[model samples]
Structure formats: C-alpha cells, structure tokens
Target chain A: MRGFPSDEELMKRCKSGDLSAFELLVLRYKDEVMNFIYHVIGDYHRAEDLCQETFIKVFENAGNYRPRERFRSWLFTIAVNLCRNELRYRARHKAASLEDLLQADPLSERFLIDRADTPDMICEKKEREEIVRRAIESLPESQRMALVLREYDSLRYDEIASALGCSVSAVKSLIHRARQNLRKVLLKAGLGEGYNAGI
Target chain B: MPGYRLKCEEVREELSAYLDGEVPIWKRGLIRWHLMRCRDCAAEAFELRMVSRALRAWGDVTAPRSVVENVMRAVRLRRRKMEEERARLIARILRIAAPVAAGVIALLWITLLPAFYLSYERGKVRPLRDELVTVRVIPQSELEQLVEGRMF
Candidate 1:
C-alpha cells in the first residue's frame, strides 16, 4: 500500500545524488516556481533562468534540507530570495522598474490574452491585465510578495511568513496593506464592478 | 463573549486575515458581529472580497516547457562532470597504487624471501637431516648364494 514518494522523500534521494529524484522534483514544481518569479519580477526570460537557478540551488543544497521542514515552503524561500537579489540588482543598476519594462513588452502581453476574444476585446483585456500588473508592481516589495504568495500560490499565512522570512503578524499586516492598496487602484480603474457598487 | 465588540477600524484591519481564515474563532465571531450591524464596514469587507476575487481571476501565465528542459540539462551535465571527476580520482589512485604495490613485491623478493629460506634451512631442515639412518645392498655374485640359502 505504498503511494508515490513525497517531496521530502524525493529530496532525501536527491541528497544521495539521485538525479532521477531531482528530475521528478523539477518536473513537479517548475511551472509554479517560474510563474511566481515572473509575477514577482515581471520578466519571462529572466524568470525562466531564475527558475532553473532555484532548482540548481536546491539540487546543490539538498543535504541542507531537513525532513521536518515543508518542501514547498523551502522551495519558495529560495525563489523569493533570488527574486530579491534580482530586484536589488535592478535597483543598483538603475534599470527601469518592472512596470515600465512590462509596458514596453506588448508582445509578451499578447500571449497572455485569450485568442477567442475579438481584437477589441483582446486589447481591452490586455489593458486591464496590464493595469492590474502595474498596480501590483507599484506596491512595496514585501507587500507585493506577500499578496502574490497568498493570492496566486494560495500559501497559508504561516507559509508566507516562512517563505518571506517574516513573522506571521508581519505577513498579515503586509497582506492587508497590499489588499487595501489594490482595492484603491482597482476601484479607480473601474476594473471590478463589485468594487464600484459595494464601496 | 456577550460584552465584547470590535471597533470599526479594528474590524476593517483584521478583515483580510479574517477572510483568509487566519483569525482566531473568538475574534472571527466578533468581526462577524461588527459586520452585521455596520453597513460601511460590510461594504468595505465586500469590496476587499471582490478585490481578492478579481486578482484571482487575473488568470495565469504558463511556464514555457524550456524551463524544465534547461534545468534538467544543467543537472545532468553537472552529474556527468562529478562522475568524470570521480573516475579521474580513481585512475589517479590506481596510477599511484600500481607502482607502490609492484615495489613492495620486488622488495619482498629481494630481501625477505631469501632470508626466510636461509633461516628455515639452517634452523630446522639441516638438523633434521643429520639425525637419519642409511641402508646398503648386496652385490650380484652374492645374490646367487643368497638365492640358494636365502641368507645374508
């Protein structure tokens, strides 16, 4: 009555230099980790590279993983740290902010739009998505990260705290502030009807 | 529980945590109590809820297939390099070990084997040989007489 090996079990095997187990882990979480990075930094190509780097770091540091820790939280912690470093690098180099960079890349935005919609609808939807992305990017680093982890990845508060290396209370505050900020923006843009009617 | 009531600001602040189900049961009941009577606070909560839904409905971007492919490729390459390094280490050890082993055998033949044989021959075999008896045989002419009388 044995099921498939868990993430911790695969990590244990990875510690013993089992590449197959490492590959299984990669195949399982690659998209999630990549998408998280993309959302955080708003760059697809760099996210791909950082996603690969995250797995490589996990592979190299497999021995450091304790069985008691949640594998998903630990994995996110690595991804978050790399995103921070990338952001820091961008700041240090005076590169354009994520919102501006994403604005310049309309082709990348086009792929995210559904083709079933008419051209006009597609343009409108793309504009809405861009506004949302921009509103997200405008938040402070910790707030943006907390909101994304909770909203997209559906991590528990404790998991978000662990991934962000903060206390649960701090995470709660960050998410609350992030929601309030987004609510303001979404209401102004008239993106969601519930916002206009209810508020 | 009967006397407790949360202020409007307090309820609104913790509303996100309440929505996420991170609040304790008692506080949750209090927030619910406040939202029931306060129209403004209820509207605020509803707005936040809708905001959460909108973000969720923002949809997702799928990770390109190349991400996993490139990751696995890097992992496999590193593994191959590690294997090659181990092979080289073993080869180096053998390269060093083969000569050392041959030298030890040569040294043993040159010094120890002869010394062992000499000691054994002088100490045990020569003394044992000195203590033995000898026997002699009759000539052919005496054999004919021995055949007639069967005496020696």
Candidate 2:
C-alpha cells in the first residue's frame, strides 16, 4: 500500500513477506540478467530458463540476504554460477548442438538479411564477425568470462576480477589471451591483410 | 641494439593492453617506437585492434523483446512460487506449534482440575473425620472414644 521502493528497500520488503516488492525486483533485473545469460550460453530459451532459475534462487535465498554487498554483484554471482553449471552440463553430456554454435555465429543473421550491399562486402564482414564470435566462444571459460565482464558488462578490471574470483593480473592475462586468440582467428579468416595494411 | 626489431610474439603480448590503453607509459612508448619501424608488428597491432573493435560491436546485438518479456514472466512466476513456498513453511511450523501449545495447556488443566477438587473435598471432609460411625447406630462420641482408646 506504499509507493514503489528502490531495489535495496524492495529487497528489505521482500524479506518481510512482500511479494509485490519481490516482483518489482524481478522486473528491474530480469532483462539485464537475461541478456547476460543469453550471451554466455548463446541460446534464448535456455537463457530464459536460467534467468528464471536465477531469480528463483535469489528469492529462495532472500531471507539469507546480507545488505553488506551490492545486490547487483550478488545477483551476478548467482547468474554466473548458473552459466558455469550450464556449460559444464553441456560438456559432460557432449550435447553441444550445432544449432547452439550457429546461434553464436555473429553474422548468421546477415546471411538472411535482404540488404542491398555488395555480396562480397557483406560476406566479408559476416565472415569477420563470425570468426570473432567463434574465437570468443572457444576461449577457456575463465578467459571468456573475464572478457565478457570487461567488454560487454563494462565492468572495471577490479570488478571483473571480483566477478571471476581472480586477481587483477589474472583478469588482465585472461583478457589479453582472449584478445590474442580472437586476433588469430580473425587473421585466419583473412582480415589480416587489410588489418596489417592499416597499421 | 639501437632500435630493437619487435617480433610477432612480443607484439602480441602488448596488443591487449595497447588496445585497452592499460600498458605502462614506457612500454607503450616502446611498442609505439617499434610500431613505427617494424611493419610486421605494426600490421599485427592493426589486426588485433580490428578484432577489439568487432567485439565492441557485438555488444550492440540486442535480444528480442519477446524474449525479454518471457524471461521476466518466468522470473515473476518463480518468485511467486517461492513466496508461496515460504508462506507454506511458516504456516506448517505454526500449525505444528499451535496444537502443541494448546495440548500443553489442556494437559496442565487436566492434571490440576482433579487435584483442586480433591483438595476442596479434603477441606470439607476434615470435620467429618471424627463423627463417621452412624452405620451401626454407634454414637459419634463413642466412635471417637473407641478410636482414642485403641490408639492409646
């Protein structure tokens, strides 16, 4: 029966048996969390389910919430853990779907676009994007996670270190290696000539 | 080594920090000095820079609106279910505790009621204790006297 509350206030209310407060919290974070998961897992439906599961875990454990840490960090920790579990499950099952791989193709949609650009140019860009995406996806999970936190989430290096539970130097190394791998992939995909000519 | 020629490996090591602008000033200057003279190192830097650019572009890819809404709905339902579950647990605990409390009160009443009645009955019957020989037409005084003689 009160005005809408901020996230911290909402969390307090949720702890005190306020479902509406919990729902508000869900609405606030759902999209961002989903986006994070989608990029990590490269699947919409699975990411959605994981997003739901993440909030469920958050709700179930809300009673154990300590306000000392930021709620966003806590939420991301849960989401990242879920992403790890999903990756592990896929690995153990050996069920890495080609569809999942294609979904990750940075340029897969470009192939379907009816753009008026020259086919050669479109194809070239698509190939470059695809190579970059694949290279990212193929990195060691730790490196990939660090890269994602840094590049996509716009987290500081220290923040990424905290998220990945690593040292700042380690985070730096991970991103460096990830970039190195991406560059190699891009080179193999034939962007090396023009790229080299530019510098 | 007036100007050391940068190798591909060395260039690769600095590429990440160079793109991020995280390299130390001296190291950056060194890489820059090498970039100016070493065409191979320069080319490699360019390629790596392009890769970083492409990665930044990928961040622009947005998930569909329907996907966002569906995920949110799923999250809402999950939270609602959890809330219901927590309420159920509390209700269950209360259900268990309430009857135990009531039973403890009931047990206390049952134990005390007879004891209270018996104490009241004892007070009322105390005076009658000395005069209870009417069954065989014996006088109350005679009964008391007989009992006293037997006790002495």
True-structure lDDT of candidate 2: 0.72
lDDT of 1 by residue, A1-199 (tens): 1468999999988999888888889989887887788788877778778999999999878879998989999999999999999988987998876567767766466565775788898777667777778888788999999998888888999999999999999999999999999999987888877435644
RMSD of every prediction: 5.8, 10.9
True contacts kept of each: 0.66, 0.31
Query: Which sections of candidate 1 miss by over 4 Å?
Result: A97-100, A103-107, A192-199, B86-152
List, residue by residue over B1-152, the lDDT tens digit for candidate 1.
79989999999889999999999999999999899999999988988888887775456667777877888888888879988999999999999999999999999899898889988878997777898878779898888988988753
Write the residue-wise lDDT of candidate 2 on A1-199 in tens digits.
3675667788898888676777678777776777677667766667767887888788778877788766777777788899999999998998556456666654446433447767886666656655556667788888887777666766667666766667878878898888778777766767656655554
TM-score of chain A, cand. 2: 0.78
Q: What is the DockQ of candidate 1?
A: 0.40
Report the CAPRI category for model 2: incorrect
Interface RMSD of 2: 3.9
Instruction: Go through the candidates in order and give each one's DockQ.
Output: 0.40, 0.20
